[model samples]
Target: MKDVIVIGAGPSGSYAAYRLSKMGLDVLLLEEHKEVGKPVECTGLVSKRVLDFVKTRSIAGKVYGANIYFPNGKSIHVEKNDETIVLYRDSFDKDVAAMAIGAGADIRINARAISVKENNDSVTVKYRDSGQLKEDNAKVVIGADGINSVVRRDLYRIRQEKVVSTLQYDMAGKIEDERSVNVYLGSKYTHGFFGWAVPGGEIIRVGTGSYRASAYPYMKALSKRFGTNRVLGITGAGIPIKIAKSLFTKRSVLIGDAGGIVKPLSGGGIYTGIFSANLASERVANAIENEDYSQLRHYDKDIRGSIGVELKKDGFIQSIYSKIGDRSFDRIYGLISSEKIIDTINRSGDIDYPSKVIFKVLIRNPALLYSMWK
Candidate 1:
């Protein structure tokens, strides 16, 4: 039996396998897709902190600021020194998978995990590869599968969170400002969420997500507004909005979207997923070395303690947006477009962790509270 069996080959699974392999654990990474990255669903906008895990060679563009458009055609521009990179997710996933393989973890492609059964001492993973069914036993099982996870379904019975439907298109066009991303805020455009245009090397990616709206019409409208002609590629996926009720059981754990750790506001999961995976690896290693599978519970506690508060706060903010209309957003934008608020955001804003600077901004402009709450 292997020390660990990871059920997905995305960044989360690959990174967890890499970390476990580095710790000298026997790890097997499985990928359902034939290739590591294909039919990409993410916007691939990542902060510099992601560089610590993988070295990316294909950078579509870099964003140093954001232009937030309000309902009434008014906009607020926030600039920062730290830049966010638009990655080619295909290359990024391959890079992480290569790192895992280099660290002695075995990777199998076209292997889809169908079910998982936990015994007292070990866990068995049933999978199908090339039309052949196979089973593998591991001291621990880590489910890094995407939003629709079989592993999660097999291990525990918990209430699943709502999934946000997203649609994006890669259009052939020249963006006015490649260094800045554009976000459109209005119920007409995105329902409760927002529409975004991210510049790539030769194409601009325009997309949107919402809990109660269809994204295709919004994406089409955004593409028309951008005056883009050719659509090079299109992809869509369901993003989990809430964290899972339980992240682990006795001998099995879920990471990444399977754990529903995707950021509530931005729908970004790479950073949080990797963060959870890193924490899981430590606990998994300890569980294996000591022969006590209960140590896996630490992974759940650590993830919740580290990111649970942020997720809850973000969810609340999203709920506020969902309840309000366009005029309310315009009023809120009028209050936040000031130099003081903009300067504060430029100085302390973060895409991954917005709560860090949100409180400070709220403290500076108390009137904004009245706008949101009232």
Candidate 2:
């Protein structure tokens, strides 16, 4: 039996495998797809903190500012000192997989994990590979599979609080502001969330998300406004919105989307997933070395103390965002767009922890806080 078996070769899973393998544990990494990364589902816009995880060659472009548009036809441009990196997700995934492989982890492509059964002392993962069924036993199992993770559903039998349907397209066109991403907010356009146009070098990525309705109509409208119909690629999927009740249980643990640990406001999971996976790896490694699987509970506690704090803050912001009407949004926009408030946002804005600037802005313009609630 191997020391660990990681289901899914995505960034989170691969990073966990990489860290565990580097710590002298025997790890097996499994990928469902024939290739490492394909059929991209993310917009690939991430904060600079992602650099702490892996070295990648998939950076497609960079932006230093954002233009947030309210429903009233006015917009607010917030510029930051640091640049956000746009990546070609396929290459990014492959880069993380390479690190895992180089760290002495055994990787298996075209291997789809169908079910995971955990016993008193070990975990058994049954999978399909090369048209045959197979099983592997390991001391521990990490579920980084994704939004519709089979391991999470089969093992925990739990679901996320909500799932947002998303639609995104990559279209080749000359963007007006290549240095800034455009964010559109309106109930008529995107019912539950927001829409965005992010420049990716020669192309632009346009996307949106909704609660129970289809996001395609909103995405089409946003794309049309940007004057882009020369579509290069299209991707659609459901993104889990909130964090799960728990992340680990005995010999099995969940990381990334499998644990529903996405940013409530932006739906970005790359940095958070990789970061959580790194933490899980440390705890799992310690548990294996001591043969005490109960130590896995610390993974959940550690994450809750660290990133979980940020997620909870963002969740409160999202709640305010979803409740505010368009008229109130425009009024609040007027307050936030002022030079003083804009300066505050520029000084403290952080995509990884957006609440930092938000609380500061609210403190400077207390009227804006009232508008958001009204």
Candidate 3:
């Protein structure tokens, strides 16, 4: 039996396996895909703090100090720090996987998992190794799987609801200014979700999300708006929108999407997944070493204590956009600066509606303070 078996080799799984491997634990990392990060699904727009924590940093593409957009041809511009990075998602994943392997975890690519069985004190996972059936026992199981996690089903017995579906493309484009992240709101702009323009010098990451069920038709609709069909390279995927209360269990714990840690608003899962995986890896390892499952007791509290309030505020933000209509988004983002945006992102992964964060943003842009009430 392995000391830990981390399912899914995404950011979360890789982080967990990496951390535990550094601790000298018998860790096994699993990835069903032939590659670690392919068919790049995420925009990879992350805050500076995250890059600092992982010690895997990225350079800026083009920083926009403020947003430039208008509703009814009325434009508003807000200043920003231009610190956010536009990383190659595939490269980032491969780097993270390398971090784990360097730390001494055994990673298995092309290993697909079908189901998990927990018996007595240990868990056995049934999966297909290339093609044949295979099983592995673990003293502890960390579900680092993505949206469709078998680990989540085996442990939490919870279903993923309210996932955000999206499609994006990387194409040729060079913008003179780089500090602004272009955001568009209102149903007229993006149907079920909103469209984003994260500029990467000559490349652009353009995509939208889905709030309501049965919105598959919206992807094609959005592609036309972004002119992705005309682009040479276009790619997209479904990210499990995690709006759950909490995602930890008795003996088993879910990390990343398996734990439903994606943003309530953006469906950005990489940072949240890595953050949660770090928390879970440390807690779970301590629990195993000390023979104490009690530490897993407040796993939610620890994670929420870190980023919960941000998630709640994001939930509020999403509600406003989903129901309030389009004209509000440009102003909403303009009022919030890059610093405040990072603060919200940093804190939201842990909790819902952080009052302190709201207060800061309100102070910065007093006008929207009323909208917070609205």
The TM-scores of all predictions, comma-separated, are 0.97, 0.98, 0.85
**Model 1 lDDT tens row, 84-112:** 98889988899889989999999999999
Residue 335 of model 3 has an lDDT of: 58
Better of 2 and 3 by TM-score: 2
lDDT scores of the candidates, listed in order = 0.87, 0.89, 0.70
Number of clashes in every candidate structure? 0, 0, 25
Task: Assess the local accuracy of residue 56 in candidate 2 as a C-alpha lDDT between 0 and 100.
Answer: 84
Q: In terms of TM-score, how similar is model 3 to the real structure?
A: 0.85
lDDT of candidate 1? 0.87
Quote the lDDT for 268 in model 1: 91
Candidate 1 clashes between residue pairs 3 or more apart in a chain or in different chains? none
What number of backbone clashes does candidate 2 have, counting pairs of residues 3 or more apart or in separate chains? Answer: 0
For candidate 2, what's the RMSD?
Answer: 1.1
Off by over 4 Å in 2: none
Off by over 4 Å in 1: none
Model 1 quality (TM-score): 0.97
- Which candidate, 1 or 3, has the higher lDDT? 1
lDDT of 3 by residue, 47-155 (tens): 6556755666444363434343434434444443435566767878888899999999999999998888777777788888888899999878888888888988777
